[model samples]
Target chain A: MPTMQPLMLPPLVIETQNLTKAFGQQKALDGVNLQVVPGAIGLLGPNGAGKSTLIKCLLQLQPITSGSARLLGREVGSEGREIRKRVGYTPEQDCHIPGMVGCEYVTYCAQLCGLPFQAARQRAHEMLDFVGMGQERYRKIESYSTGMRQRLKLAQAMVHDPEIIFLDEPTNGLDPKGQAQILDLVNSLWKRYGITVVLSSHLLHDVDRICEQIIIIARGRVLVHDTLENLKARRRGAAEVVLSGRHQEFESACLRRNWACEPLPNGHIKVEHHSDSLNSLLGLLDEIKLPPLEIIPSPNALEETFVQALEISHATA
Target chain B: MPLHDTSYQHWEGVHLGLWRRRWVIARAGLRACLQGKWMRHLIVLCWVSALGMTTVLFLVGQLLVANSIVVKWMGNFNPALQAFAGMLTTWLEQHPEISVRTTQDVLFYYFCIGLMRAGIFALGMAIPLLITRDLASNAIIIYSSKAVSRGDYLLGKFITAFVLIFLTWLGPVCAAWFVGNLLAPDWRFFWHSRVAVAHVLVFGAASMTVLSLLALGVSAISSKEKSTAAVWFMWWIFGGVLAPIAVQTQPWLRHLSFNFDLDQLALAVFRPAHDLTIAQTNIPILGDMLRGVRPQTLASLATPELQGAVAALLVMLALAAFLIRNRVRPE
Candidate 1:
């Protein structure tokens, strides 16, 4: 038995150095150099943007054609076994060992991570409970619905209590309520449990709901990776404000505050919301007594960011 | 934004490492294979056939004992065993080790044959159950993403099928050996037949390893469960039908086309010091009564030599190893 070594995890959960994965002439992950800190990270990319490929490469499920990567401070390929022990991954496709029930499957996965059988069983049930699986947990995975299977996949991934969980398209094929339920559960992993969650999806709304960090990939390259606040802040001067007072007064008030405010034809002032937060703008309104009737931050700011990132990446390519 | 604490929390719990973890896959694989109705039935059927074959061999072994009564009774029919028994008893009394070896070799030969036949069906079922099913469900991703390396996964899968294959042969072979020794004239029977089990242990280990490799290789390359089964079944049918016909045209076909090679291996491993009269016919009065060519069991004189068969099997092992190694890649 190898003696357990105390972990010295790096500040970055994932760090890739010029990582490139190619199939013959086509590169799936082209010169991807990234340093990902731990948090709820949304990996957003178009179809064939190498989101799945990147996840697989980081997990070492797929061998990297070249370059290098590290997960949780352990070098990939060399320390893959130890890395895998602490990381949980679910690919986009549905997968389960046939004939095993949900609990058994999860327990089996836990055992594979080197947990003893009894502990594995206990942890399996714990994860199943955490995933909100009910009596149907006893049912074979083959008979599970898409939502149930998705939940089961998450349960199995977490059964080992991994430090990092990578979920690719986890919310794919779920209804709105099911999606919210899964998203809430996933949110808790990052929020309450503090497990690093790397959620890869095309659903901008899903990412916008929970992710603190956003990575947008296009043309097999990362166009942008920044804090969600920073990404949304890029759409500066897009916040709309409606005041109960006169429009001229608000415009004068905004001018006095030196905020980048634009008056649209619809009688609303667009303020840049300095520092990417509306709290300061509201404080200014309170001080000026230009009582605001409404404050509408750009709801599509992340969407625009995602689109513009892809466009820029394509343009550069 | 606050950066993470960056303190990796290694588990302080009991954890099984590489050496202890593979059994999980093997156990799960076994559960799945045994859960299938047809798989269970096929194993049961194999055991039943083996039991019957063992019973026949036991009865035949007894009839060959160098005693006077049976031979005296059959004297009028031929008087061959009576004279043969006189020389056999004299030779056996001088070199009793041959008698012991003869007893062990015949039973060991039948055990290998039964095991190979049963293993073919088990492989047909097992490849689909263990290998392609994992592929079809994309369970490979789940496994590959876990702590399991390709070698661990392959070993786990091999153990599952090998266990089933040996179970089909070992149980009946031991039963025959035990019962034969029980009814033997003295305690020397146990000493004499102790080597019988050795042949089975070595043969079972070697052949099953190759067969397990073949199963995994076929399963890895195939995309669907049905296709995996079809490939194995096709191999069985292809070799079964072709080997006989190929035997006529190509003398070397025995080494490559069919299972004459396996039989050749069995014959080589279990060759007795001297071919007993009863070993030829396996029946008391039949050695003289059947006055004809060699028994069907030994009729493969034109079959290629043992070296040829061994080279063919080695080639097969290499090919299977190549397929499995290439296909089970995480890439």
Candidate 2:
């Protein structure tokens, strides 16, 4: 093993101080401040919410407009080369060198990460194996299917066995099974391989299942940044019941029972759980004889938290 | 559990220096270029050209020596000897003023120019495969995402295309020089020809650097491979073949052609060492003979001035560098 340089492997994965990026009059990253640690972090945002821009800024792939940023304790632009040595980035687009076979392309990427030729080739093969790619590795990347290309991108990103990897929409255009397989590999990157991952996407289901930390950005500003557990724990006693358009009776019953309820847009009623247990809502459901079709309890849901964060950001704007 | 207790992976290998990574880019580029059928065929053609070119130099070196073995061999009455002699005589046919007193330095200049004519094709084929394909495929993201910098990427690509162009010309020139020197009469022959070899090196470096970068610049600006190839070929072919037609009228229009400018530079580089007398002028008499124009003296050719050649090439090189610098970044 090579001697580990402390500067190369800092404890904090990313630290940005009021980092801003602008194109002419419009700012893509509006004075964003963040300190990311090692974990499976989901960067969630709606379309055009600066998720990709933030990743690009953090990697120094684009010039910052103002302020400063660092990766693994090194300054963003000045030390970008060193920072990239310990980091991997799988871009949201299909990026493969033309006229190269899958294995050769991966080997080239490993070499670019500073491995010697033989070592790079061996590492590339090992990474491809780890990503569950097989004989298809010998084929040209131009001929690869979407799933195969995604796997190739993943393999190339992990070729050097980076400490952290930024996956930008890694599951885009993949079938459900392929998406599941990729997510499984991504989960393993953090679990079995112990590599930090920053998964940037708008898909809440994917994030909810794989990410421990969530950073939600909307309109170029961070709406929320906290642990998924903490965000979910912040939820109050609440239950959203599918009342099947019979909100008036449920509203009357909830009013008599001293429980506040809001009728949702999708024909559901969100009831504030004042009772110590869910049996209160259950007992009320039995008394009203309006028997709900489905009841969803909060205080452990990411969807509610995600929606609330987006709503607050929208309201602020 | 955020992956059941987050920890750094165990493989904490040392990152090599930045130069090594740049070399990696260059090495990969060279491998990719060589994969093309045109590149492979061009390499084989260069080899064949080198063999043919050096064989002439070998005979010339033998001629420069006293008591030459080939001259002695030609005296044989064997049927094979007569046929070989006939071929040599036909090839060695030259003007009365040029045949007996040709110097090695002037010959080296012609040799360099000859190989360059072939090299234009090599450049046309190899350069499009470099930056154009990368841009077309959107692989700039792949490179930018790595530890390699934008400068490193361009330099790596420059080296790859430069080597391809060099192999097609300078590499063969060096081979011809070495083979010729090895057949020389003695150490004095090597000393006598040192100036010519130096001229070839200087000429080779200048031309290859300018042409390779110019082709790369064309590649950088355009994303489509076929259009890039077309643009490069048109620039060289039109400039080389058609520009000479206008040279008869304007004469100075030779500056518009990179090949003409480089050839003029080649003449200047060899001028100091040429052994031609004031009564004679350097002329590839057969070139004019084939063109159906009666052979004329160098004084009548009206070539582009050396200073103009130098300035034009410098401007061209700057433009190429600027294009590559701007377009090498991720879009």
Candidate 3:
């Protein structure tokens, strides 16, 4: 028997194949297959979506059920320490040592990551600075705000300068500004330091802004895992363009031009076309000179896509 | 491979992390013990209680040893004093190494024994408090990084607790011995009293091992507040005033009491000042044994050795590892 050799190069720095986790009678993660590339990959899911479960399985903090995960060419379960050494993790919950100074806590974490004392200290200082926590580095963690505490957690995670970092809802309890600051720090860490980030969050906007690829999961199963482009492609069938001209004229003109256009009740024409024909609309506007005040491509309904995935997951379940 | 990294902390063994974690936690516990007014007050109360009990016991023992007319006269009216004196006198005669007189001797014998016994109890009591604090405050994860194994983390905590227990017992023992010697002048008899005191200390340390383990087990099983309640309730059931009563009321129940065996062991080990007519028993199989044999007795019976300490330490470290493994359920 002859087997065909594989063709597509795997983009993932970390990938899971039929990964599953169960807690007694309850299954926490059920047959999850996730491939995370070298850029920011968002792990989005609802409360029981198994985002945390997947992350924990990857870290080997929780045991896997049936399948396996690969991180940086190594299997997650058996090579967790090796994976963890190269990958940082900021837990969803606020884990703070009240009496220890921020620097002390980070330094200890660095040491645990196998850095020597002087080097750990140096790296800890650099990490604090990287997270914009330099001024408050000497202060005890008990005095830190929720934002500062979150930043401290982030700093400790990166103190060893890991190759990949897992941030589980890093902005979970933070204010908007705090969230922005943290996201900014996360973005910089990825952009400047070349750290691959697996940011797990329920907030779609956060995922939309930072992630090049998104995996939306619900109820312990993956609903979708694709590039943002693929997701937009998935939504292309219902594409609409709003026009601010005489609806009748625009409709007739579009019909004559063989463009699928429908007139709305509010004197706005909804022009429908394949994503490939978006260029044709622009070209039509230039030729016809039916200059409307605005020609806006309606934003792709991501919230709808999310709800649709949920519906699909629910129906399939 | 670079033999010399030219940096701090060249080694990467679990001990390196365990040592630092142990130091930090021990310092934190010591600081808490010293700084908090309530803790300081608690320590004061402990010292006061131990001192009061020791002084009373000493006075009563002295009265019995002297066989004073006042004591006899008192005994005529109250048979309680007569019985107590007679019992003490008998107790002293079996092993006479407990009551040292010279400044050095008294301090060595009484202080060491007092400190070891009282301090062990106090320190053992304090351990649950520290564990509960860490659990309650949710700060335990701060010092315990995911970088180290759970075994290493628990070993660190156990090491810290052990060191704290040692300090608690040692300090009191030194103080008690110093005070005992100051009150008395005869050095030879005092020296003889030292052996019993030393044995009591070893017994106290042995007791502490069990107490700390039980405390940790309780802490691992319950929330901090519940853990505190469990520790106190277990202590009352096993160690405090009710234990003796239960032992006395039901003769068979005496075998189950930790304190009963501990007290017996202490008495046997610390053969008081007037003790003489030594008796030794050697069993063919298990050697000369003390009163009760419970599950902990096997461990208690083993002759104290470096090898035994290492084995006990491994068992403790293993138990701690098991506790941590089951503590956190996947969310």
Q: Which candidate number has the best TM-score?
A: 2
Per residue, candidate 2 scores C-alpha lDDT tens digits across A203-254 of 9989888999999998788889999877766774788898665678889989
lDDT of 1: 0.77
Error of 1 at B90 (Å): 7.7
Candidate 2, which segments miss by more than 4 Å at Cα?
Answer: A1-10, A239-271, A274-301, B1-10, B76-102, B248-253, B272-274, B278-296, B300-304
Error of 3 at B320 (Å): 8.8
In candidate 1, what are the lDDT values of residues B1-331, reduced to their tens digit? 1132322223459679787788888878888778878878877876776666556544444444566455556566877757775555555455545565565666567666866887778778778877777877888888988888878988899888877776666665666667756665446667766666677667667777777777788888776878878988887777778777875798676565435666666666655323444443443343465445455534453332679878888887788788877777654
lDDT of 2 by residue, B263-302 (tens): 7787777662234431134344433443443335443333
Q: Native-vs-model 3 lDDT?
A: 0.62
Better of 1 and 3 by TM-score: 1
Ranking by TM-score: 2, 1, 3
lDDT tens per residue, model 3, A1-317: 99999888756697888888888988888888877778888888888789988887887766788998898888876665567667788888777654568998888777766676787787777677667675688988888888898989998888777778899999988999889988987876667667788899999888877877788888889888887767766666334545555556666667887668765565556676555436777666666766666554534445567889998988988
lDDT winner between candidates 2 and 3: 2
TM-score of chain A of each: 0.83, 0.82, 0.82
The positional error of residue A219 in candidate 2, measured at the CA in angstroms, is 2.2
Query: Which candidate leads the pack in lDDT?
Result: 2
In order of DockQ, best first, we have: 1, 2, 3
